[model samples]
Target: MGAAQETRTFVVWDYLVFAGMLLSSAAIGLYYACRRTGPQTQKDFLMGGQKMTAVPVALSLTSSFMSAITILGIPTEIYRFGAIFTMYGFSYVIMVVVTSEVFLPVFYKLGITSTYEYLELRFNRFIRLCGTFLFILQTILYIGVVIYAPALALNQATGFNLWGTIIATGVICTFYSSMGGFKAVVWIHVFQVGIKIAGFLSVIIQGTVVQGGITNILNDSYHGGRLNFWDFNPNPLQRYTFWTIIIGGSITWLTIYGINPAQVQRYNACKNRFQAKLSLYINLIGCWAILTFTTLCGLVLYSRYHDCDPWTAKKISAPDQLMPYLVMDILQDFPGLPGLFVACVYSATLSTVSASVNALAAVTISDIVRPYCPSLSEKTLYWLCKVTSWLFGAICIGMAAVASLMGALLQMVLTIFGVIGGPLLGLFSLGILVPFANSVGAFVGLTTGFAIALWVGIGAQLYPPLPERSLALSLNTDGCNLTSFHLKGNWTTTKGTFSPNAFQDHSAERTALMDNWYSLSFLYFSTVGMLVTIFVGIIVSLLTGGRKQSIDGRFLLTKEDFLSNFDYFKKENHISNQQLDMIEDGEAKTSELSQPITLSTQSV
Candidate 1:
C-alpha cells in the first residue's frame, strides 16, 4: 500500500518456509540415496523396481503434468482471454479414456521402461531412436519454459534475480532426482502436489473473502463476460471452441500423459497393470480439481481488477506477475504468505524438472545407451543413470538462460512438438489399432509425419501470421472498493477495455501460405500431424508389400479389453463347436466299424 509496504522484504519466517520445502525435498533424496542396497540396478533406478504404490504414482503423474507453466499460464490465460480455456477440464475426460483403455494397457502389458521402447517392439530400433530423440528434445526445450515461468514472475514480483532463481531451482531439483532416482521423483511429487493445493486454496479463499463472497464474485465475473466457454464453433482457427479444446487438448494430453515417458515411467513402476490404470484416474481427477480452483482464482482476479487492467496500469509487467502482485497486495502484512506462494511456484517447477530429468535419463539409458552396451555392469549402468540425470539438469538450466534471448523460440519449439508429437503418438496408435501395420509402415509414417510437421511448423513460425483471437471479456474496476479491504496504493484502475487485436488491422494483408499453414491454430497442430502420419503410414504400409501375417495379438486392441463378457462367450462357443465336431467324427467311425468296415474288408 505505502512505500514501505511496497518495498517489503521477505522476513525470516518467509525464508524459513521456503527453506523448509527445499530441505524436505533434499531430505527425500538423502533417504533414497542411503538406500543403495534397495534399488541397486538400472531397473530399480529407473522404474523403482516396479513395486511403487498406486496413490503416490497417481500424485506424481498429476504434479508432473501440471508444471509451473500450467499453474501460472492457465490463470493468466483465463484472466487475459476469457474462461473459455477452462474447457480443458472437460477435455480431460477424453484424455483419460484414451490413455487408460488404449495407450496405458499396451505400454503396461509390454512392461517397457521407456515409452519409446514400444516403438522398437512395434517397429524397429531406428523408429525407437527417432521417437526417443524427439521426446528428449521436446522435454528439454519445455523444461526451460517451465523454469522460466516462475523465475520471471518472481523477478518481477520480488526483487529476486531471475537467473539466480532459475539456477537455484534447477540445481536443487537435479540433485534430488539424480541421487534419489525414480522413488525420489515420485515421492517429491506427492509433497509438491500438497503445496500446490495449499497455494491455490489460500488465494481462492482469501480472494473470495476480500471480494465480498462467492456470490458477488460470480455475479461480477458473469456481467463482465469472464465466465463464458460454451462456443461450439468448428473453425480450426478459433482458439477455444469446444471442438478445438476437446479434440486438441485431448491429443495434447494424450502425448503428455499417455505416450510421454515422463508419465508412463510411473505407470511401469506401479505394482501392477490395474494400479497403473487407477493412478491414471486419480491423476485425471486431481487435474480437474486443480484446474477448477485455478480457474476460480482467475475469475476473482478479473473481479478484483475488472476496470483496472494490470498491463494498462503498469501495476505488473506481465500477466504472469498478476498472481504474485495479488499475493503481495492482499497478504503483505501477513509476513510468510507471499513466500508460501513463491514456494508453491518453485514446488511446481521442481516437480516437473525432476520428473523430466529422471525420464530423460531413463530414456537415454534404456533406449539409447543400454542398447549399445548391453553387457555393461549393473553398477556402471546405475551410475550412468545418475550422470545422465545431472547432465539433463545442467542442459535445462542452460536452455532456460538461452530462452530469454530467443523469445518466440519457445512457441516455435512447441509448434515443432505438435509436428513431432502427432506422428509419435500416431506410431503408437498404429501399433495398437492396425494389425497389418508393419515396422516399415510405422517407420515410414514417423519420418514422413516428422517431415511434414517440420515444414508446416517451421513455415508457420517463419511467416509469423496472426490467427483470429478468441472472444473478448471486458473488465471494470468502477465498483471496486479498495479502502474497505484495508489497502491504500498509488495504483488505480483505468476504465478503458483491453483489445487483443487492437494493434492489428482486420484488413491487414496476408500471404497465401500464411493463411493456409501459419494461420492454422496451434490447437489443431497435433491432430493434423497425427492424421498425416496415419494416412501416409497406412498407405506406405499397403504399398510396401503389406503385412502378410498377423503380428503379436497383445499389440492390438480388441473386444476383450472393453467387453469381457463378449470375449468369454466367443471363446466358450468356439470350444463347444470343436467338441461337438469331434463327437460327430467319433460316432461316424463307430458306425463304420459296425457295418461299413465289413464291406471294406471284403473289398480288400
Candidate 2:
C-alpha cells in the first residue's frame, strides 16, 4: 500500500499547478474588489446591479449546484450501481422546461430579490420566514457536503490533510465571496467550469486510450453489467429503476432549478426576462454535457477495473475516491496533470461554496435581517452582507466535520435536498400553482411535510436496504495480486452473502408496512415529500375556508398562463394590459418609496 501510494505523490510542478489555480481565483476576487467605486448598494453587491448576461449566468447556474458532488459523486454512483444513473440527464431536461415556463415568469414579473419574498407576497410573513429558514438549513448542509467531498478526494489521493483542505477551501471561497459578492462568484464560476471540463475530459480521454478504445470500454461495461439502463421496475424501494430515476429525479432537480434561492438569484440577476430564460435553456445543455462526461467517467472506471475491483482490492478507502485514484494511477507520469485534476475538484468546490455563501448573505439580508431591521443603512447593510458571508463560511466549514460521517456523498446530498428541499419546493408550488392555498395551509403543510420527510429520510439512513435489495452490479478481485498488496485489517470483501443477524432481529416487532416505508429508495424522498405537502396543503386550505382574500394575479400562474407564449413583458392571454400596467406602476412606486436609513453626522 505504501509503495503504491508513493507512486502517486505530488511533485514540484504538481504543487505549482495547484497553487496557480488558487491564486488565479483569489486574483479574480481582488480584481472585482478593486473595481468597486464607492459604498456598494444591496443591488450591486447581491444582485450584480442586474446587468448580468445570459451565457455567464447560465454557466454560473450550472456550476453553482453541480459542485464537487457532481464532479466526484456522480462518477462514483455510476461505477457502483450502473448507467441507469444517467437517466438524471432526462430529469435536467424536465427541470429546465418547468422552470422556464412556470416559475421564471412569476419570479421575473414580481422582481423580488430573495425567492422567499414571493412567499410573503403570496401568503404571509410567517410562511416566508419558514421558507427562508428551510433554505438556510438546506444550503448550509449541502455546502458542508460540497466542501468535504473534494477534501476527501485530495486526502485519499495525495495524502493532503483532510481538515486542512476543508479550511483552505472555506477560507478562499469566503474571501472572494465576501469581497466581490455576486459578480465575483459568477465570473469565477465561468472560470472554474472550464477547468472542471478539462479535468473530466483528461480522465475520459486517457482512460479510453488506456482501455484500447471507446468500443472496448463499452463492451467491457456491457459484459460486466455496468451498461444497465432498461430497468422499468415500478418499485419505489428499488434504488435506481427507470421510474425512480425519471419521476424522482425530476422532482429533485425541480427543487433546485425551480425555486431554490441559490438558483433563483441567478435568474433574478439577469438583464431581463429573455436573458433569464435563455440562461435556463443554456444551463440545460451545460447540465447534459456534465452528466454525459461524469457518466462516461464511471463507465471508464468500470472498464479499467473490470477484473481488479479497487474497493474489493483495498486500493481505495471509499467509492468517492475512485476518480482520484484512477487519476493518480494513470496520470502520475504526466507532470502537473494530477495537480490539474486536484484544481478541477477544488474549482468545483469553490464555485459551489462561493455561490452558496453569496446566496446565504442575500437571503439573510433580504428575508431575515431586512424584515426586522428595515431601517438599516445601505452602507451598513453592505458591510453586514460581507460579514454574513464570512460567518456562514465558518459555519459550513464546521458542518464539514459532521458531513464526513454521512454515508456516501451523492446519496447524503440528495437526501439532504429531498428532506429539506422537497417541502420547500412544495411550499413554492402551492403558492404559484394552487391559487386557493392560504397561509394557514402553506405553513401547516410545509412543517408537516418536512417532519414526515425527515423521519423517513432518517429511517432510511438508519436501516438501509439489504445488500440484495440494492441489486449492485457484481465486482471481482481475481486479477489482483494479493501478495504485494498490504490490506487494511478491518477491510473485508463480503460478496453475495447475507446473514439474518446482519441487522438487529426486529422483524416481529416491525410491521411490513413500516418496513416498506423505511426501505423506500432515496430517489423518491423528494417526490414523497412534495406530494405530501401539496396534498395536505390543498386539503387543509379547503377545510379552513380557502383564499378568503383576493390574490393578485401576478402571484398565481393558471394552466392557461403556463401553456401560453413565454413573452411575459407584453400583454398576453394570462395577464391583461391593465394588470401589466399595474405591475409597472407598482414597481415605480416601490422605487420611489424606497429609502435608505440615514443618520446625522452628530448621531454617528
Task: Give me the candidate number with maximum lDDT.
Answer: 2
TM-score of each: 0.86, 0.90
lDDT of each: 0.73, 0.82
TM-score of 1: 0.86
Q: Model 2: clashing residue pairs?
A: none
lDDT tens readout by residue for model 1, 1-604: 2223235456777778777888899889878899677439887889998777678999999898767776676776787667888888878988888888888766765567888777776667887888898888888878877787668766666667768889999999999998889998899999988888887887888899889999988887888777787888787766578888888778877877778888889976876555677888988899888789779988888877776666545565456667777776666777778778878888988998999999999999988887788789999999999999999999999988655532232233346458777778888888788888877888888788778777776665455446434444554444333412212222233121122232334465777876666666666778877877788888988888667855755556766655542232235334354544442333212111111111111121
Give the alpha carbon lDDT tens digit for every residue of 304-389 in model 2.
88888877676666777778878877788898988888999999999989988998999999988987887999999999999999
Off by over 4 Å in 1: 1-5, 405-417, 459-468, 475-508, 564-604
TM-score of 2: 0.90
